[model samples]
Target: MGSVVFSIDAELGWGFHDYSNPPTDRIESARPGWKTLLEIFETYNVPATWAVVGHLLLEDCNGIHADHPAVDGWFARERGAWRDRRDLRFGPDLVEAIAEADAGHEIGCHSFSHVLFDDPRTTRDIARAELETAIEVARTFDIEYESFVFPRNAVGHRELLAETGFSCYRGAADPPESRLRRPLEKLLATIDPQRVELVEPTVDKHGLVDVPPSLFCFRFEGMPRAVVETLAEDPIVRQAKHAIDRASRTDGVFHAWLHPNNLQAERDARRMESIIAYAAEKQATSDLRIETMADVAERAQ
Candidate 1:
């Protein structure tokens, strides 16, 4: 049988720290969705890889970015101490909840501070520091990360990841030809969502399993939002179910990923539930197997 892997980019505000005006309201609004995700996975007995930011596991920080590299010539602005920004910066409680969940989820690293490893500014020292800090912080919770998801999906520093004991990393899907291609594709998806390509996990030169993503559970907004919401069904759910079915028939891997923050509205959560329920149903009948990124990596090895 084929397999399906779900990976959640579980970074709170750290995902947007580089933005001039971070969406504080949206970030806070999505906090509850994290717990909702755990509950949903429990309901379906579906485990996922939660690639958490290292900083989120911290109780407090000095509110400084002196150790990390500067992105685009400016360092990440720390408004105040981490204590005051607990909702955004610190989330050990949320990480603990994922660890305590009954679904047997895997907690992996998403860098220390969402630093883009692919950027030229991110030197070897910076990359090493990020991985080291992430490993150190996760150790406090008795968790040893074996899966690494690059920040912003801008992959880099593979040797460092393998040296740090990570066995696998998620790779991006096919790149769009142009910037406009993505927005245009999103709009077109509202009409008829395409089936995502399935991949077989491959072992790279660095000895890390490359579990590339099949699709991103993109959130519709603006005009596309209106069109999607008015539709009789969810295109995202339809697309995911189709991909899962195709994977089962082809004996390939279907990997679906999204941010918990994407579950902003009730409808968004319902869409996720629909996709997971479909995958679980298929698994119950031996059509498809739901596995974590670590499981794929282990099997690939």
Candidate 2:
């Protein structure tokens, strides 16, 4: 049996702080849709990894925000633009809900304030503070984060994750390499449903394991409604099925990920259910083990 890991980037408003709209308008918490996700996982007896933002653990911030060492603030703005808007950042209730999910579900780190580690403006001091603060805050809730998912998938500071005591991270996507016409390869990969290679968990020289993802959960943001509806097979579902098949045949790992907020839309939620149902079927019939990212990392050790 192959392994399948579901990683959720569990940040509410903090994940969408860049927007001028109040986080309430753009982001959501565990109350409405997120609770349903927990219920679904419980029904299927599925385990997942939730890479929670550190600030969300704080019991309602009374005008408290991270004192980032970077002059530009978290995003490098001179005046902490979103600091006073505590409602947009704090969500301790959601943190608790995730902790109380499936007994063996993993709680991983998604940075303290969704800091972009790949930004050139972000210094080592800033990165260190972010990582350290996440660890410190998680401790308050008694959640020791062993796996991490980089904010916006901007990976950096590998040694820092190991230093901060993380066992593994979700590495960047791996596309098939091609020597034949590069542009054609890109177009084909984009247009066709092809099998993506399942990542074999590998340990870095720094002792941090890389448990990369196989495919993304369904999202319909960029495509037009008409095009999406007209497609013979939902692209995301097809991709996920292909990955699952490849992994099952090869005894590989198929890791799928998405954000809690993605399920705020009913369409996205249905797509997620479809994917989860397929996963459940694979688990019952195949040796497809559905595990948390930390669980996979532990096996590698």
Candidate 3:
């Protein structure tokens, strides 16, 4: 059996969402959190992937349209962190900082405007336009991002990806429910990402090596860390990771990911560090072919 493929994603959106107020995580929590995680990977010499948003690469969009009812209401409802502010300007030089930090690492695409592909009319032209935007931003830093991780873990628009000249798509993974559903999710949540096998119909059916890691190893966005840590002892995350660890049918890849914002809590930093340490131990103990999304995607070609 070949080794496993490991990937990490830092989802850089515009903001976070709070049920009663705007999310306070995007700038304050997520960006720095990711910086710390990336440093961890660097220190361990771990080859990881950063599935970044194009908005983070571009110069902040200036001039908010608060006059427009829709624009004003959008930020009000979803107060989360993004690479840029609502009007397109960031509070600081975060965009440049990421580009500089991404040197020697795989800087992959999360889409130019994550919403473009969401459009039903996302033709090849529009798709390339969106992808090229990210490509162009990467180019500004002299980094060529060929790998792609679809925004929202939605990689259905393979047409756009392939049309834009991408080699692979890193999409969603199997839910823990099918196998040891409960326990797996719990353990995986704490130890590693709950990265089940890729059980969905994606680019693979069309002969593409759709690279997906185990997922749902943790609670998704807006879910509190207190709730997630409580569920760490839950049966779901545990069963999921156990299945992956002992599976005879494990593939050339073992992948899992989540937004860094999910780890915004004070204690989450410790939890995330533990997870990274565990993955490092896994690499030492096994011959698993752990990799960044870019590495596997390039291999698919």
Best of the two (2, 3) by TM-score: 2
In candidate 2, the residue pairs with backbone N, CA or C atoms under 3 Å apart (3 or more residues apart, or in different chains) clash, namely 1-287, 72-76, 72-77
Report how far residue 257 has shifted in candidate 3, in Å: 0.3
- Name the runs in model 1 displaced over 4 angstroms: 65-76, 79-83, 176-186, 189-194
Best by lDDT: 1
Candidate 3 C-alpha lDDT tens digits along 52-155: 66656655453232332221233333233432344332312544444555334566777664543444555555567667766766777676766787765655
Better of 1 and 3 by lDDT: 1
- Runs in model 2 lying further than 4 Å from the true structure: 19-31, 62-67, 75-87, 174-191, 219-228
* TM-score of every candidate: 0.91, 0.85, 0.69
TM-score of 2: 0.85
Candidate 3, 38: how far from true, in Å? 1.6
213-278: candidate 1 lDDT, tens digit per residue: 987886445566657668657777877888888877777999999988887788878988999999
User: Ten-residue segment with the worst summed lDDT in candidate 3?
Assistant: 63-72
TM-score of 3: 0.69
Number of colliding residue pairs in each model: 0, 3, 44
